[model samples]
Structure formats: C-alpha cells, structure tokens
Target: MLTLLAQTGSAGADSQSLAFFNFITTHWQFCLLHFLEFAIWGAWIVVLGNLLNARGFTRKEIGSIYACMPIGTMISILILGPLADKYFSTQVMIGVLHLVGAVLLILMARTDNARRFYWLTLLYALAFSPTLGLVNAIVFKHDADIFGGLANQGFPWIRVFGTIGWIAAGLSHTLILKKGQPVNANPLLLAAGLSLVLGLYAFTLPADPSKVALAAADAVAGEPAVAAVADVGILQGSIEMLSRHPIFFLVTFVGAMAMGLYFAFGALFLEKTGVPPRTVGPVMTIGQWIEIFFMLALPWFLGKDNVNMNWVLLVGICAWAVRFGVFAIGKPLPMVLFGVAIHGICFDFFFAAGMVNANLIAPESLTATAQSVYGFLVYGLGMYLGSELSGWLNQYFTKPTTAADGTPDTVTNWRAFWAIPGVCVAICAGLFFMSTLGRPPAGDGSNAPAEIPAQASEVGE
Candidate 1:
C-alpha cells in the first residue's frame, strides 16, 4: 500500500511537471498555434525567391512578391488589430484569418503568372499577419494568469517551437520537394494544407477576455487595466505608446530592415557560394537549428533580475554585421555555413527579444495593440522598405560580364552588396548599445508589468 501511494504521488508530480513545462495553463494551445503559424510562413518564404528566380524573374520582380507580404502585414495590423482589441475574440479572429488565408494560399499554388501570384500572396498575407499579434496576446494573457510577473517566464520556450516549425518546413522542402527546384511545386500547397489545419485547431484554444470588458474594468477607477487600451483609441494609443518609448521603435526599424535583406536575398547569397539547389533548404535550416539553442538560452540570458533586453538586441545586430561580412567573403561551404549559423544570435536577439520587450512594456489590455503597432512598424512598413532597398542594391550591383566560357553573364558583386548593409547595421547596433548602456531591465512589478503605465488605458481614469 505504501509503494502504491508513492507511485501515485510520483505520477501526480509528473503531471504537474508537464503543466509547468507548458507554462502551467489549462493547455498548451499557444505553443501549437505558434508552430502552425510559422510553419505555414516557412513552407515557401525561405525558398520562394529562388523559385521565382528559376522562372526567369528579375530580382526586382521577385522582390515584388516578397514586398506584398509587408504591405499585407501593415494593412492587417493597422485595421484588424484595432477591430480585435475593441470588439472581437482574439482566437476567433485567428481561426477565421487562417481559414481565409488558406484559400488564398491554394490560389497562389494555382498561378504561374507573376501579377496573379503577387495579388494572391498579398491577400493571403493580409489575412495572416494580424494573427501574429493576436497569438502573442493570447500567450501573454495565459502567462499573466499563470506566472504573474513582469516578464512571461515560459514565453521563450513556447516561441522556440515556432522555430521548430520553420525547421520542419525546411526539412520537408529538402526531403520532399528537393529544395523547391521547380518554379511551381508543392510549397504553396503544403503551406495551404498547414494553414487549414491550424485554422481548425484555433477554435479549440483558450478563451480571451474581451477588450470591452477590460475597458469597463479600467473605467471602474483605482483598478488598472488588465486588457484595455488608453482612451486615445487602440491604434492611436498604441502609436502614442511606441512613440514615447523610442528604443522599441528604433530597434523595430533596424531589425525589420535587416530582415528584409535576409528574406529578399539570403538564398541568393548561398547560391553565389556554390551551395547546390538540393542543399539550400538544409543549409538555411542549419541557421534555424542553431537558433533553437539560442531561443532556449534567451530566458537565462535576459531572464536575470535586471538584464537589459537592449543588450540582447545589441548582440543580435552586431552578429548581423558579422554574418554579412562572412557572406561577402563567400567561399568554402563550411565557412559560409558557420557564418549562417550565427543567425541564431542575430535573429533571436533582435526580433525575438523585441517581442518580449514589447510585452514587458505594454499593459495587459493593450498587449495585442502593442504587438500590432510594433508589427506594422517593423513587419509591414519596415519590411517593405527593406525589400525596395535590397532590390535596388541588387540592380545596382548586377553588371554585364564575360564568363570563362565567353558567354554574356550578369555578374553580382556580392562582396560590395553584402558589405554595405553590414556596415550600416553595425552602426545601428552601436547606436542602440549606446542608448541602453546603463539601463537595467525592469523587475518584479507583480501587480503590473514593469513598464510605466502612465501611457496605459486606466491612467487617466
């Protein structure tokens, strides 16, 4: 009888352990949500440029396809964010958007015409982008309920699965589609299928507290907002909040611009280094595989009592410069791969850290709005700018030349192209570091997030 009781106790402890590992929520729906959300994006985003290139599209034309996503993201965040924050259920919005986006993805697969492809993708992105913020809000709300701290303790671990999703997508492309060799292949269809699965799965997520309810809570006076934006309106309040905190806005711009170049031309850089068509996806996955480690490390790195998240961003952008420099050197597959692997540091530090920081600073009510405002500034407008800039850089560097076979070739001066962005980003990193040099991260605002709530909904009320 004693032994049986001990075993039962052990089983109970194991169940508790599992729940803690899952951030102690009723379920781990958000982790699955992140996985599917990113997997759909990963299915084609990493290789779509190369696919378009295979079809005889110019770099500029390929950029147009890439550019549409930011345009779509910007529109979704600006419009949908306010609507969701003010009126609708976050999970419901996510489900509906993914379903709509799935149809668009299917349509994208059926097209070979560039204009048709561009419009279809644009519509899909518009449908898909707002979910990024809504998912974050859901995760934050769950974290607040469970962990009750300024920083969401299990968020990094949860988000790391999203990276796993991207890795899985790349693995599928490499193992199944063989690095997206054909201009029209299985990528879009694969992504569409994944989107459909996630759409249906979204309805099963934890329910959200309405912004209207939260707004009412704020109006009760003395009790601060757990989920309402300030009286200035969701969009206006979010913008005002971001503007007040210059650090967030600055890093968002830098990170978004750097990402644009990576999204637009990263594969092309690998191709220049003689990576084979079949190997491209795997090679890229190496970076994300490395990122998984960094993502896991982030909680420790930035989770200290007062470790400034800005310091994390500083490391990321510096790594970005180093990566471009290494890519510029461009020889020996191992060397190129080594540099690519540093993406672990580059991406996790800036973008991932930025998301965490955004959470730290915004009130519970405005979490979605904060994420949306940041999304619009970075993913939408910032990515669009980067796409244009990178495209122009591509055009400027390509020149007519004679190859060893005396065939006319358009030569890409990869060294110069890579170095320019590297220098500029390095400077941006330095500037960011200087700005946050002595600022420690906020700590232990158990009743509220560590950020100043003067900019929040209940402040005046």
Candidate 2:
C-alpha cells in the first residue's frame, strides 16, 4: 500500500507541474498584450520632451503637450471604462482604440507644427487612455485561469512582462538609435508601428465578455456632459467599494503623490548627479527591470492563499521614503543605481499590489471602473498635479548660471529639491502606518484571512 501511494503522489506532482507549464505557455497572448501595450508608452513617453526640445518648442508648449494625456484619461475613462465593463468586450475595445491611436501616433511623427501635433496627441490620448484600465480588467478577469483558486498570484507574474516591454523600448532608444542626439520622430514612428501591431494582436488574445447586467454608466454612454455626473453615481458598486475601504482610497492617493514626485523630478535629479542624458532612459528603466524580481516574489510574500493588503502597501510606502532618501544624498553611479532599483519594492508593493487588492473586493460588474478609479487617482490627477508643482519647485530652487559661450543656463538646486520630497515622503510613510485606514481584505472570499485590528470593523462592508 505504501509503495502504491508513493507512486500515485509522484505522478500527481508531475501532472500538476505539466499543467502549470501548459498554462504559462497558453497565456503567451496575454503576455504579449501587456508587453506591446506598455511598449507603446515606453517608446515615446521618455523621449517626447527631448524630441520637442530639439524641434525648438517652448517649455509652455511642451508642458501643454504633456498635460494632454492626463486630461484625455480623465475624459476617456467616462466613456470607455463603462463601455468595456458593461456594454462591449474589453479586448475588442482595446484593439479598436489602439488601431485609432496608431494612426494618430504616425501623424504625430510626420507633423512638426505645434497645433497639429497637439491635436493629434490629444486624439491619441482619447483612444489610448482607456486601454490602461481595459488591459487591467482583462487581466484580472482571466487571472483565475492562470492559478485556479489563487488568482492574485498570477497578476504579478503576468504584469512583470509589461515591465519587460518597457525595458525593451528603452533599450531600443539607447542602443538602436545614434548616441547623444535627442530621440526624434523615430520614437513615435516606432510607437506607431508597435501600436498598429498591438491593435491587430489584441484581437488574438483571450476574450473579456461584457457584463450582461447593465450599469448606469452604460445607460449614459452617449448622454450629455452634465448628465454623466448626475448619472455616473450609477456605478454604485464601485463607489461603495471605495467608501467601504476608505484606506484603499487614501493609500491610492498617497501612492499617486509619491509616484508623481518621482515622475516630475527623477530624471532631472539623476542628470544633476552627472549621468548622461542618452543613458537616462536605460538607467530609469533599471527600476522596472528590477521590479520583475520583487514582482516574482510578491505572490510568495503575500502568501499562497490569504494575506493582509495593508501590510504590502505600508511596506511600499516605506520603500518610497527610503528610495527618496537615497536620491537625496546625491550619490554617484553604482550607489545611485541602488536608489533607482528600490522602485521594485516601491511599485510592486503600492501600485501592483494595490491592483490585486482592488480586484479582490470589487464586484464583478464593476471591475473595470474600480481599476479606472485607481488609474484616475494615480496616473491622471496625481501626475497632472505633480507636473505643475514640480514646475514651480524647479523654478523656485533654480539658480541662473552662465555657460562657456556666455549664454544663460539654469542650475537646479538638486540637493535641496530632492531633500524636500524625501522628507515629505518619510513623513507620509510614518503617517500612513499610524492612520486608521481600512484595506480591502486580501484573497478571494472563499478563503479570506482576517484583516488587521485597525480595520477589523470595516473588513467586509
């Protein structure tokens, strides 16, 4: 009997291992979905400003261009988020939008005139913004297929590939392009081509069927502007989810703030530390590449079945504070790389982990909106406010200096500027732990673990 049982157990283990391999293999489309989706952003995001500078655009004009996407996101989510969740298949919308965006991006590369470029970008943003939420919704919807009852584990594993795509795009900028010249229309051309490929590729991925039960957002998809606000409350489930776990909303806001600060000033700070401009994209991407390590381990850290979401978020906040401190020190190369690398901890814990938590408790009917709410808080509002604030701070802390040709150059007070955000985030991290915040309980409800005492009363509401 013992010999027979041992044989059965060994066969079972082998069978399970084979099944896991099959799952990963079959999910290549999802991985490509994430990879190409991010590659589109990566190709142009870091290089666009540099390219515009090369084109002789003013700072204000460039700032307006930067502002367009957030504005587009805020607007696009209203229509697309609801449409995907309630009325249309998510993957189909993703494909269609990318197709539209591809044309706009190509037009952007071909046009040098400011007004035409601005409008093309704005239109592209409208087409592109919803894809961020749509992709997350699609991934979350299919997570169960990857890990059966343990869906959250699959998210980080799958998401790590998106970081890879971003890294690949950065490398293309650094290695394939000539050294020391600002990334020109070529980056957008690359993005446009990728967008077109992804547009076609999206349709080949797994389907995310629209919810049969319609929500208020769907009823008003074509309605007038004011009607949307009055009617938008129809997203009662998503709204309730936020209200129930106020802490999630708070943490999301703070996470946005921290990331906003980093986005606004991180590159400039590194340049001040003497890193060359051409290398900036690769150096910055070091964070995303390293993020894969933490992302790989996240499932283990959060436990196989049940975990506390707040703990992960809190640690991420702490990592941000520490990372900011590292940046503040204004250290040299290898050491500075350590600071950049901390992004693995910072992003995986806060943003990526937060997504897991958001999906965990959200009603099936409202998953897209839930993710949209998070995106609007972080990428939309947070980034916009951060960019504006960073502009003011940049001017405030700058000292005018003369270059070798007697022309004026702006010397930023890097140490002081970096210290301000560092101190602020450290304080925020401390305050985050001390606050009475409720996190969405981790795990699918079938095997839910208890939450921390601070949020115990509000755990399931």
* Best candidate according to lDDT: 1
Clashes of each: 4, 0
TM-score of each model, paired residue for residue: 0.77, 0.76
The candidate that achieves the highest TM-score relative to the unseen native structure = 1
Candidate 1: where is the Cα deviation over 4 Å?
A: 1-30, 85-87, 138-151, 154-157, 179-183, 204-248, 308-310, 355-373, 400-409, 433-461
Could you give me the TM-score of model 2 versus the true structure? 0.76
Q: Please give the CA lDDT of all the candidate structures.
A: 0.69, 0.66
lDDT of 1 by residue, 101-126 (tens): 88998887777788888888788878
| Residue 149 miss distance in model 1 (angstroms) | 9.9
